[model samples]
Target: MIPPVSAPDFLVKAGWPGAAIVPLAGDASFRRYFRVLDGGRRAVLMDAPPPHEDPRPFIAIAEHLVADGFAAPRILARDLDEGLVLIEDFGDDRLKEHVDAQPDNEMTVYSRAIDLLVDLHKLPAADLPPYDRAVYRREVGLVTEWYCPAIGLAVDEDAYNCAWDSVLPIVEQSASPIVTVLRDYHAENIMLIDQPEAYGLGLLDFQDALAGHPAYDLVSLLQDARRDVPPEIEAAMLARYKALASPPADFDAAYAVLGAQRNAKIIGIFTRLWKRDGKPRYLAYLPRMWGLLERDLAHPALAPVAEWFATNIPADKRHQALQEFALA
Candidate 1:
């Protein structure tokens, strides 16, 4: 509960001068956000304190997304040295809250989200780290290094690395056009902006954007780790995306590979959050994420990873220990 060190001074210097700043909910990152009210104007004050969080990538990516005609928040003012930025407030209508409150809008909102990806993927992934085999392996490795140990399962790092070594090639072989993978493009990060001339989806938490398989973001959208997107809706959206965008050869296989990779990484990440970070709420998502992981592992392309899971983690044992840890 450490208050953002520079937020107060930064806000005053930015002309808010003790404006009514209400704390907004933070995400998994170290960054904190506040809804700042100054007279009749309202903006979001982002506190991305340095050493732990950097504002440069968010700033650069925001500019890049805005330049590309996307709905990323406009950076009204910034102090990169202090890792703070005052950005356009897109209001409280996060796509998750919108769709959850009105289930009927799920289809329309999700369709438009997929459409945003279609438009976004048409452009190339510009200057960013490549989401290649090495990076992917390291990410999923969190499972072996932290999760397995936490669940009292011995991990052979060699075998775990070997399992991913077999799977990474499939993800890399996609013939589809690669685009900037917005690392997190789920319901929560998307904003519902109803305007005639808008991208319709206000993007957030894209500081970790990278150059990688186009299917990565799609998986993030459809197979969300935090929420359940109805199976029928997910299927239809996948079909719709394929129909509208001529995805490359082996798109389905590539999608499955990326899905498995991302889910496996999440499984490890959630466990670490509970055991090390003492964030028990994240543990609740483990069962849901396990289901998603199981679904992804069923894909033929992920057989190696699947075999590794079956041998190491039986279905009944998957989240049982983690659940107990959550209660404790």
Candidate 2:
């Protein structure tokens, strides 16, 4: 991947002259990150090139998180016109790898993450766009818009949306307080940093933060699209959050609704990444996503959505169908 042409000058202006820029990572977006090494000091340079992306949201959210005593990366410098920003590096100890290596510490680490969310929800949400029903419908529509067509299944789009319409209101009308929902709060996006202020967790990829139901981020964490959070751990963590937050009695239902919604969105997105963007690596996660979606669909709150899946994308047409397509 090519680094931004203006990155060098931006870094130099930000006081990191002649820093060695090393490729770090890229997500499912138009952004790329690099580690800028200047002698003994190191920082991350975000290259969110213009027209397609704007780094303002990330900068604003990062500043908000830091100001609220959270462990989001500190913004060292920025050039909004070029869509480049120099921010603090939280190191490479991502929660996903950390847990994968030491399975025994999973509960302890996840418990801390849940506690962080509980604390974060207590604070007033940042000025951000609401994760309203329109957003939900647009996101969930990705499955039908991308996945179904990719697999050559002409689904009944009307019925599919009808199912979602029946349940979207439940989450939107949740009794729990609306809070800043870090749209991608999974293990991969979290760094196991040494900062106590963030309860040893360094947040990342929160540029798409939104004011939504408290359960959305929790669902994102427990029902991770990229990793398997053990069933027991998932249950325990859900219980732990309930005990700490004392959310509404229907919180479990809200969790299930959001979980199903997010999983469906990921399925469509991963497919689009493969078909439209020519990035097929994301296809490998289809089975895991389907598994999580099935679990969420089993919840009584998702009756309509579950029925839609059963009738339209039946058992054989789910992940198995996608696997066959991949092999073909």
Put down candidate 2 lDDT per residue, 146-178, tens digits, no spaces: 988878889999999899999988888778898
lDDT of 2: 0.92
TM-scores of the candidates are 0.96, 0.98
Error of 2 at 93 (Å): 0.3
- Candidate 1 off by > 4 Å: 1-5
For model 2, state the Cα shift of residue 266 in Å: 0.5
Report lDDT (Cα) of residue 269, candidate 1. 85
Candidate 1: give the clashing pairs: none
| Worst-scoring 10-residue span by lDDT in model 1 | 192-201
**Model 2, which residues run further than 4 Å from truth?**
none
Question: Model 1: how far is 181 from its true place, Å?
Answer: 0.4
Every candidate's lDDT: 0.86, 0.92
Tens digits of lDDT, candidate 1, 1-328:
4346677788788787877778887888778888889889999988888788999899899999989888899998899888889999989999888999999989999999988898888897878999998889888998888788876788567887898888788778767876899989999999888653555779999999999989999999999988899999999999999998988779898888888889889988888877777777888888888888899889888888888889887776686668885566
